[model samples]
Target chain A: MTIEDLIEEFDDLGDWADQCEVLIDMGRDLSNMSDNLKTEDTKVHGCQSNVWMVAEVKSEPLRIELTADSDAMLVRGLLSVVLMVYSNRSPQEILETDVRDIFSRLGLDRHLSPARKNGLSGMVTRVRAIAAEAVGLQS
Target chain B: MTTDMSQRPPFDVEAVRGDFPILNRPLESGRHRKGKPPAFLDSGASAQKPQCVIDREREVEEQFFANAYRGVYYFGARVDEELEATRSGIAKFIGAESTDEIIFTSGTTMSLNLVARAWGGKFLEPGDEVLITEMEHHANIVPWQMACAERGATLRWLPLTEDRRLDMSRLDEFLTPKTKMLAVTSMSNVLGTINAISELARRAHDVGSLICVDAAQSVPHRMTDASGQHNEVEPVDFLAFSGHKLYGPTGVGVLYGRRDLLCEMNPFLGGGHMISQVYRDHSTWADPPAKFEAGTLPIVQAIALGAAVEYVSGLGLDRIHAHESQLLGYAHEQLATISGLTIYGPDLEHKGAICSFTIDGAAAEDLANLLDIRGVFVRHGHHCAMPLHEVLGVQASVRASFGVYNSCSDIDRLVDGLQFALERLIVAEK
Candidate 1:
């Protein structure tokens, strides 16, 4: 399903337990980021959990390839949402996309704990920064 | 092989619970039909403040907050006068020789840093070894590493054994004549293994080296007076604990040092209050405790800490220790029933009421989140003891450390929550 569609599914889930289960489910299905890419530069700080995100430059169509991983299940689920939205998008498109607005629309910013919120924002910010850098390097 | 060794606690835990208003706070799941209180199992990080401590802090802030030691005014002078009394109480609490030995710092971290910088910086010569254990929290480890770097001293560590206690077989090897100091935790925050502090302290002294006990965990859970009174051990040269962990407010920590050593040490931070007399070119330092306590003190928190210590004393440390031991024993029995659950630390007998565990397929962070939703608070991650976790060969673990207010039912809730997390998150997927 698309990212927006999954968020709607999250909104439909009435109980906290159900939402948590869905998030954990998302985590279980997440494609593991290769260990080689999980290096110091790719590591996201300010997370209570360790999270690493890396973006590979795609040629021709100029789509940005993003991969992320977290030691925490909830953080991994959040990373999945970022992967659904930002991955395989053109560098310009990824930069233009308001990820924070998307997160607000999904009510993720309010739902997650302060620590998790910080982690989510850190992941999103790092991805956006990489996208911006990737676009800059091409020019 | 297990025996029913549990005895009834002397004091009323329910009455103790009433003193902590935070325990009565309505959890997200609300209170139980059986009247179970909120399971606060993370006292190793910080404890819930009692009403007395809260009131004392408010009283200090609302009525008697003025810059201490500088004012001749009624409020400021009164605060200073009261603080001196509090200093004596703190000294007696840890069984220090005098109030001259007790130095207040920001917290355990700041206190350890003070010792490492002031004492280690001044005394540590080239090729001198500063020894610490594998189980020490980063607060106790990192500062010494920095000190060793500054002073050209080598850092050595006594390895934590597979059995979760320190390997003392090479005690002589680790504590050589070159060893200038030994920094050890009174209890491991993760493993909960109580170290043989007095023996180690005596050993260190015999070798002509000093020892510093990181009493941050032990001070809250049990009696810390180094005198041979209730489950007491001989006091070491330096001891440190945070006020917040002892049911007081944050921003206050006590560091107890030997009077002679403190007098001889150079002042860590060069500031106004730490100086006795200031000259344009140089300044002579103040007396030991004041020499260390530079700048405006955390007056409110310090007063709250005094109240906290009094509250604990009122409860009686021996009684508290016994009660927690009973709960911890019961918790061990309950946890043993769970499959694929591995707990860190020595078997129940030698440890505090801390249970650091990881389930077979469940991640520590995931289990903690699930437990949080169920109103069972626990600490997850390295718990500032990453080196210890590395030694255990695990990335992280969930720690449920009990305080005086914790009950047997709290452990039940934790175990039940772990089961729910396992069934729903880990097993359901399969």
Candidate 2:
């Protein structure tokens, strides 16, 4: 499903319990991650939960494909949302997108804690950094 | 293992709960229950301020707020007297020899750092060692590491046993002649393991090493006799505790030092009030406390801390300890019934009010968030003790620490929240 569809799904959820249930379900559907990808380089710092992310630069469309995982179910769900927004996007597109507003619109900002919000932002920054690097390499 | 509440003097937890305004309010999240009172179980992090403490703070701000020791005006004199009153109260509370022993700092972290820099900086020599423990919070561990590095001394650790208790058997091996200091926590913030401070203090003294205590966790939960007055515990050279953890205000903590040691140690921070005479090139320092307290103190917060001490003292520490002990036992009894739950630390006998645990599949963060949804507040993650978490064989764990305001009902809500989290998260895994 598209990121907008996921946002709509979150909006339709009743309370925190419903939101949490749907989020954990999204986490369950996360792409299978290898132990090798879960390295120190991919690890997100200043997070209460362990989160690892990787970005692969695709030459065909010049898009960045993001894959990530977290030991925390909520963080995994957050990763899913993050990947859905930034993955398969051009470096310029990735840089220009307003994902923080998108997260706030989805009510994830209100639902997730300040600490978790920091982790989410950290993921976004990592993806942007990779895309920026790709732009550098292309230049 | 829980005591019969009927046999003991009735601890009116409901009345106590009324004193903490936060306990009466609904959760700000407004998630599941609309009007459920927040079950605050993270007092180990920082206790909720009592109404008296809050009032005391407001009184200072509204009535007679002034920079402490700055002026001879009525407000300034009143502020100084208030601060000195707190110093005397705290000195008495911890069974210290004199109010001169009490040196106020920003918090426990600063108190510890002062001891490390002022004491260790002057005293530590090459080949000397500072022995700490694996279960110490980062606040207790990092300062010593910095001190040892700067002073050319070695930092050693007293390891925890398989059950997370300190390895008392290895005491001789760790505490050597070279051990200039034995910095230990009175109680583990994560494991809730109450160490035998008296024994450790005695042994450290036997080896001619000064014993410093991180009493942040213990001072609130149990009676602390820092000077060994009316207690079997040996007099510790240095002791540190935060006011916030004792149901006071933030931005204030106490560092108790032996009179002789405080006199001998160099000033930690060189600034306005800490010195007696200033010269163009060099300056003479003030006595013990003023020497350590270099800057303008947390005047309002420190005054309110005096109220916090009075509040707790009026209630009696023994009663609070007994009440929390019952709650801890009840929590253990209930949590054990959960299929995959594993509580860390020693048995009920050796623990304080903290209960840190992890489920087989549930992440600590996820569980804590779920608990929050149910209006149950708990602390998660390594609890600022990464080495202890490493020793406990987990990256993170959920901690439910009790205070005087907590009751058995809070534990019930915690269990219910945990079960709900388990059903939602663990079931989704399959």
Candidate 3:
């Protein structure tokens, strides 16, 4: 979705300040990993919160799904922001997009804890690795 | 008609408070209602600068700004002298054996990285372990992990006890002969637990390992001397702390290594001022302090940091310690009475000036935001010690830390803001 669409979706939910909460809540709803799925294999490294991401590369384009279990709800929200930007994109698109630049545009860097920033970096790295594997398969 | 000033204790809290210019300015939001005041409680991250330190920095820049160690001009000579004097002052303040052992760097992170790269990276071998505690900030943990990774060494961690103190009882388990280095923080930034560095250093030495103490948290509020005096604790092999935390300017910090160890290690960064003799094929390096300091150092900031050390030292660290402990005790007692608040670290008696607590049913960021609206500034996060937070079973906590200038009134304002925030959260839930 475009930035405008995302902004509109956020604004429609509540006040501008509450939009973050709404986004976080959306993240919470999207993140519903079962206990059985919360294995070491699915765990995302370097996150202060326990995040598990499982993405499948469909035939036409990449489709990814992620679930995070964190005592802190905001971290779950942050993970959701990551998913919205990365999931459902092709490997080429995923690698080309500037994730750090997007985070800068959204002012996510200032609002996030250093650990969360590192977590975001870890998430980006994992997604890039997955994308690279997919591209290698096609080549 | 004069007030009975003599009746008060010899240490003047209000006088000490006046030195910090940030306290007088309007809060960052620049607005206040009647009978409301802004209280700052984020000293655990970095402290507000005193006017003396600020003025010293400006004076250096405006008058004597020049590159150090290689200039023969008037400004260069003066700047070099000021830089060396600051080195001596820092070395004296931390109780180091000599100024030669002290190296200035960007901050604590760089200082720790220098050690990890130079000493830890060079000496440590495959199958050797570097021991650190769960309470380490990222600056302490990441460097060792990186060094170990590069050197094919193992990294081991000592767990934090339930009370958040370092589990020293199991120290022997981690201090194997294969352990080349033990790095730990003197105080926990998130939980405020004070680790016994001397004890840990003794244990490491017993097993033929050296200890590096991250004194970033302790140096600010307590007396920390690298030179072991009659009553002072024994010095660790290497100690690192930031200038900003101790009322000095940012972008300057100190790394105090034992002279012998510093001579043994290779240089971390290579550039001008660090080399002794150079050719197209080979080069020789300078002695300890100059060898580690690669380029033209942060000369102005270093001089200002010396002024800061003098300013704080004049007031006496013992007095500062007592003052902070008093405020911390009162803050702990008051915060404990608040319902649904769970504090990390040992009770006020066993900790330093930091207090990290979580309000039941409210996110730490949300609580911090609410408090911010009320002009009560606090830090809300994992505090760069995420592993410690994980061990404590908390994702984030609201930290209210005290410095030399903090008073009981500041604590009162924090309590008032917290109570209001809790009320609002509870009402919204209903």
Candidate 4:
């Protein structure tokens, strides 16, 4: 499915259980991170989970990939949910997508802790920075 | 929500609990089972407001709400009176010398940002150090980092010991001459560790550094005098806390600064109600509190906050603390019996009512979700301090906190929910 199609499908879940199941499926579907890309440069600073995200700009569209490891299974599941909307989009598209609005539509923000919210923001920041770099702006 | 007086002495628990309508109501999401009532275990994120505070807010909005300090009509005067009364009430509650020392902002985050921008932004230079512990909420941490980055200052962290308390043994080493400010939390929202503020203040003072306390977690649960005048403890230079956490309306908070220091610092935001005289060339600013209170204040919310302070004070903080302590002790004992559940914070004697714990082999989010299915609400994740979570060697933890309306039975519900969730998870794995 196209990223947009997948997001729509994920958003169709009626309750949190279905949402979580879809999130796990998304995690299983995520493209693996290359070993060379696993470095401090790709690390998200403020997340409790060890989330590593890397972005690269090719000719037509930018590509974003994320891999998160946590002792906690649901955090890994949450990272999968974050990646579904965020990965494999142009930098500008990533910035303009209104991730928070998407989260609000799913009623996910209420269930999240303040730290997870910050982590979500941090992920957005990381993606935006990569996007800014692709467009030749200092982040 | 009514407490039985026959079981114990008739404290004002009933009257106090009655004020908070949310305590009696079911959760917004309903109960776990079809017939069972919802049990709320999360008061740490934000608290449910009392009906009195809410009604007061609505009353002000309907009758007396107006732009404070700048209005010329009768409504404006009434609003100004109500707004000023909030400052006075806050000042008195915190034992400040005068209302001029109190500044209203959107909430604790903005209040702390004011200190970081106005005080740290102006005074701190490159190479100056800002000392903060690992346990601060992001609201306290990010603002200082922003200020430090702007001024080319360096940020220093005070480490936490094995027990999750601040490692005070090396406190002197951290408070060096380069330190211009020390910002710390009075009570950690995640770990529930109440630091020795007086000792911290004294240490900061000895190094000629100003100390700012984030009392967002402490002010609601205990008797806190941030004003620095009435107590023998060396006064904190600035204090910030939110109204919503203290059973008041949201969108309003207090920032207490020493009068002279407030007078010396520039205002953080500017639009209206902050200037004495305006002109094209130059406009003179008003005095301290007015200078900081720019734009239209949250007048009705402020009035409700005043009422909230009155409500909490009437319950008597000493009695409230005693009641919560009893619940905390009971919770600690029960939680200790659960295998693979590791609690982080000071010992029960030193901690407040907040408890953070991680269960083995189960994600905090999943555990929280399971607890929700059992009609128990809890906060799961890093609790806004990612650095502290990293220090604690856990990805995230489930936090169950208490408020004035909470009782021992509430803790029992939480424990039951947690045990049930753990068993269900184990069964599902099997």
TM-scores for the candidates: 0.94, 0.97, 0.79, 0.79
lDDT per residue for candidate 3 within A11-118, as digits (tens), equals: 464332355555455544665667887788877777655667776677754444444554455566666667777777888888888577766666556556586778
DockQ of 4: 0.20
Give the DockQ-based CAPRI class for model 1: acceptable
Candidate 3 global TM-score? 0.79
Instruction: Give iRMSD, candidate 2.
Output: 1.2
Per-residue lDDT for B142-194 in model 2, tens only?
Answer: 99999999989999999989888999999999999989999999999999999
TM-score of chain B of each: 0.95, 0.97, 0.95, 0.95
Query: What DockQ results do all the predictions give, each relative to the true complex?
Result: 0.42, 0.79, 0.11, 0.20
Per-residue alpha-carbon lDDT of candidate 3 for residues B1-430, written as tens digits (9 for 90 to 100) = 1124345467787888888877876654322333344588998888888889999999998998888988899999999899889999888788888999899999999999999999976798999999999999999999999999999999999987778788878888888999999999988898888887778877888899999999999998776766565346666899999999898889999999999999999899999989899999988999989999998788888999999899888777777877888988899899988988998998666689999999888778767765775778899878998888889887888999988788999999899988876665554446
Task: Point out the worst 10-residue segment of candidate 2 chain A by lDDT.
Answer: A8-17
Worst 10 residues of 3 chain B by lDDT: B28-37
Question: How would you encode candidate 1's per-residue C-alpha lDDT over A1-139 as one tens digit per residue?
Answer: 9977977886796456677777788988898888998898988887777889888888888888888888878668778888888999988888888777777777666666687777677777777887788889889
How many angstroms is residue B122 displaced in model 3 relative to the true structure, after the best TM-score fit?
1.8
| CA deviation > 4 Å runs, candidate 2 | A135-139, B1-9
Candidate 3: clashing pairs of residues:
B94-B225, B94-B226, B95-B226, B95-B227
Looking at candidate 2, what TM-score does chain B attain?
0.97
**What CAPRI class is candidate 4?**
incorrect
Model 1, position B53, has a per-residue lDDT of 93
What is the C-alpha lDDT profile of model 4 across B1-430, one tens digit per residue?
A: 1234355554555576666776676544522344444556677778888888888988888987777776789999988888778788889888788889898888899999999999987899999999999999999999999999999999999998888889999898899889999999999999999998989998899989999999999998876766556566688889999998998988999999988999998878876878889999988889989899888777888889998988877676667788888879988999988888889998987789899999887778768876876677788888889999889888789999988887777778888878877665544455
Q: What is candidate 1's lDDT per residue for B1-430, written digit by digit as tens?
A: 1123345346788899899998997754422223345789999899999999999988888887898889999999989987888898888787877788888898999999999999998999999999999999999999999999999999999987778898888798899989999999999999899998888988898888989889999998766765434345555888999999999899999999888889998898888699999999999999989999889989888877899989988777778888999999998899989999999999877899799998887788889888876778899999999999889999899999999899988899999988888887678777
Per-residue lDDT for B343 in model 3?
Answer: 89
